[model samples]
Target: MPLQPSSAGTWLRAVLLAGVVVLLVSLIVAIILGASALTGGKQESSPKMLKWKDRGTTRNLQEVILGRCYSYVTAHYPELRDKDCLKIWESLKHAFIYKNPCNITAEDYQPLMELASHPIPCNKSLFWSKTNDLVHRYTKSNHNFLTLEDTLLGYMADRISWCGDPSAPGINYESCPKRSECESNPSSVFWKKASKMFAEAACGVVQVMLNGSVETGAFRSSSIFGSIEISNLNPDKVSAVQIWLMHDIGGPQSESCSGHSIKRLKGVLEERNFKITCEENHRPVQLLQCVNNPDHADCRLCSSNVETP
Candidate 1:
C-alpha cells in the first residue's frame, strides 16, 4: 500500500537533519579547541594597548597622550600629521642613536604589577574619595577634570614610585611580592597593581564619550567606592582595582559607551591613526585609530570580555 506523505512527517525529517548538522559542527569545534589546549595556546587575548599606554611618566601628559593624539591628529588633519607626528616618529629614530646596551639606561616606568590573584575590594565610597580628590583640583567648570588616560597615567606614575621595587630584578612578572611583611614568613602575590588604573581609565573614557564630561550629582564618588580606600600614601601596595564605584556614572546602563568599549576607544582618537591588529585563528581584524594607545594602555592589547574568532 502506497502511503501519502503528511506535513508532520516531512517536518520531522527536516528537524532530524538539522540536529545531525549541529552535532557535527559541535564535534569540529571541540576538536579545534582541544588542539589549542594541547598546544598551550591562550583561550583569548589580552589587550596590547593597555600595556604600551601604561608606560612613561605620569606627570608628562605629552608622552601619555602622544601615542593616541598623533594618530588622531594625523589621520584627521594630514598637514598637521606631517608637521607634528611624522617629525616626532622619524627624528627620534634617525637622531637618537645609542650604540650599545648601556645607552638603554633610561628606565621603563611601571606603576604596579600584580603577583597575587586577590580581587581588589571596591564598592562606592572609596571611589568617591578618589574622584573628589581629582575634582577638587579642577578649575570649577568641568566635573570630570581629567581624561581617562590622564587619571590612569597619574595613578600609575604614583604607584610605580611608591609600590614597585625597581631594585628587584624583573623576572617572572607573577612572582613579585607586593606588601612587605616582617613576621609573616616568605609570601608572594600576583597580578600587579594595574587594575585600579584600568578602572579609572575605563570609567573616565566612558564618561567623556557619553556625557562629554562628568555630570554633577550623577554618582557620588563615595557611593561608588563604598568602604574601599583609594589612598596612595599607605605603607602597603595596592592589591585590587574595580570599576563598580566610579563617580559620575549616570547609570540606567549608560548609553555612553554602549557599542563595544574598543569602538569607544577608536572614537576617542582623532587624527593620525595606527595599525591595531587583533587576530584570532585564521581570521584577523585590523583597526585604524587616531593614535596608537599602546604607550598608555594597561594591557599589551585592549579587548573586552567579548569573544571573537
Candidate 2:
C-alpha cells in the first residue's frame, strides 16, 4: 500500500495523529528548513536544499553522526522495546529523512554528502550496488548499518496512556478490545503509549530508509514499510511503526496509499563549493551513491561533474 503525509503543521503533529510513512520526506524537508539559521522569514514549508562549500567534509560529518547513532541503537535495541526510546526516534528519523528513489536528485546536493570536503577515499560500491560483499562487510544492508535507533528512545511518555470512556471512532484499534481504549476526545493513556512506539518506529524506519540505497548520510531507510507483515494484529489498534508508515506513505491530504517510495534512493548532493549543473527537472536528494567501472581513474574524482562513466 502507499503512504501519505499529514496536513498537520509540524512533524510532531503527524506523530500525535499516528500517521507515519511520509515522515521520511517530511523530515528531510523539515531538516532542510530546521537546520538552517535563517529561512528569510519563510516557514519550514519551503526549505532550501543547499549544499555546503565543503560538501565532502559535511558529508563525512553526517556519516559520522549516523555511524555513532547507529552504534548506539544496536547497543540498546533490547532496552528500547522494554521501555520507550525506540519508537520516538524512529518517528523522528522517518519524519525527516527517507524518500522515494526516483525523486532523488544528485543534480542539486551531491557534494555535501562526501566523507571529506575534498573527496579522498570514498567508494560508493556497497551503498549503490547492494551486492553481497557490501552487505556482509557493512551489516546485512547499508540502510540498517548506517542508522542508529538512539533517537527513537527520545519520545517515551513516563506514564501509560489509556482511554477511559470507551467509545468508537473512525480509526480502529488492532489490539485494544474497546474503541474507547483509543478514543479521540481525551485520548487514552494506553493508546498514547502504543502510539509512541508506532511513531518512534516510523521515524526510525524513515531515517533508515533515507540512508539505505542512495542517501548515505546516516545509514539508510528502506521502502520496506509496504512489505511489513502486520496482518496478525486486530483491525482496531494500529501498531506504532505501522501507523508511522501509513501516515508517511499516505498523508492526511492524500486519498489513498499511492505515492513515491524511498527505495534505492540517495540524498547526497555537492555542497555550494562544487558547481552543480542539474537537469531541468530535479528534486531534493537524500543519499549519494554511484555505480561505476573500477578501471577508470575519472570514477574516483569527486569533482568530475558528469555522472560516472
Candidate with maximal TM-score: 1
- Predictions in order: lDDT: 0.29, 0.25
Per-residue lDDT over 1-309 for candidate 2, one digit per residue giving the tens place of the 0 to 100 score: 433454335666767566556756787888777666476655566332222111111222233444444554456343323332333334322322323211223321222211111111111111112222322333322433321111322112112111111122211122212333222221222223332333322311121122122222211233121222122112222211111111111113221111223211211212111111221001111112223233343234423111110
Residue 174 alpha-carbon offset, candidate 2, angstroms: 34
Cα error, candidate 2, residue 226 (Å) = 3.7
Lowest-sum lDDT 10-residue window in model 1: 281-290
Stretches of candidate 1 exceeding 4 Å from the true structure: 1-3, 6-9, 40-56, 59-86, 89-309
Per-candidate TM-scores read 0.20, 0.17
The sequence of per-residue lDDT tens digits that candidate 1 reaches over residues 119-184 is 222221122233433332331233333332233222222332111212222111222222332111
